[model samples]
Target: MRYLTDRKRAEGLGASKAGTEHHWYMNVSGVGLTLLIPFFVFILGTSLGAPYEEVVATLSQPFPAVIVGLTIAAGMLHFRRGAQMMIEDYWGGMTRKVMLWTVICLSYLVIAAGLYAIVRIAI
Candidate 1:
């Protein structure tokens, strides 16, 4: 009396309940990056090829410094999530676990280094 139909089993769900949350995080970060990238490019571009003093002065300003800082933070987070998802889909077992950890570590490293550099210039 316990042979459930395919539809009945399918009604519940699969592995993770947090897929939607992850999806939204990815989408939101993507949108943030979309807006931030142009500003980041503008800030970086202006400083490019300029004298070291000028570039340092430009980044020292509050506005441009904040823009670069936010861009790096958001971009690294977005990269981490996307890479984790990709590695999960393509890898398995220990390999998948190691890859996810490695990517997360690298993302944090980039974020910290970027903020440190920006702060050094801005201050």
Candidate 2:
């Protein structure tokens, strides 16, 4: 017979085998959003009271367009994951399932609309 400690036996029996991976993903995305937010805000803040054509021109440039696109993608993904974690922690059963689905769909919808707007501006 093989010998094993209780801790060892319980190591892989957590709620989900992918929990650690999700944790690391959340941490990394958190860091990414942290760094990107200031740059994005600066870019956006500068463009804020400009004329419509000027604002469009500013965002059409490659640098601003790329930064805004990355920020939108990262922000949405981070939001979705964070919301999922919160709902899972504070909810149970059907509520958790329906809430998770709603959050995921809403995040994707927002991301898609943001990307479409950015593309239209850039092009």
User: Number of the top candidate by TM-score?
Assistant: 1
Candidate 2 positional error at 3, Å = 18
Cα TM-score per model: 0.85, 0.84
**C-alpha lDDT score of every prediction, in listed order:** 0.91, 0.89
lDDT of 1 by residue, 1-123 (tens): 769975565543658656766877998999999999998999999899999999999999998999999999999999999999899899999999989889999999999999999999887
lDDT of 2 by residue, 1-123 (tens): 759975456556667766666777889999998988898999999999999999999999998888898899989998999899899899999999999999999999988998999999987
Against the true structure, whose lDDT is highest? 1
lDDT of 2: 0.89
Weakest 10 consecutive residues, lDDT, candidate 1?
Answer: 5-14
Off by over 4 Å in 1: 1-13
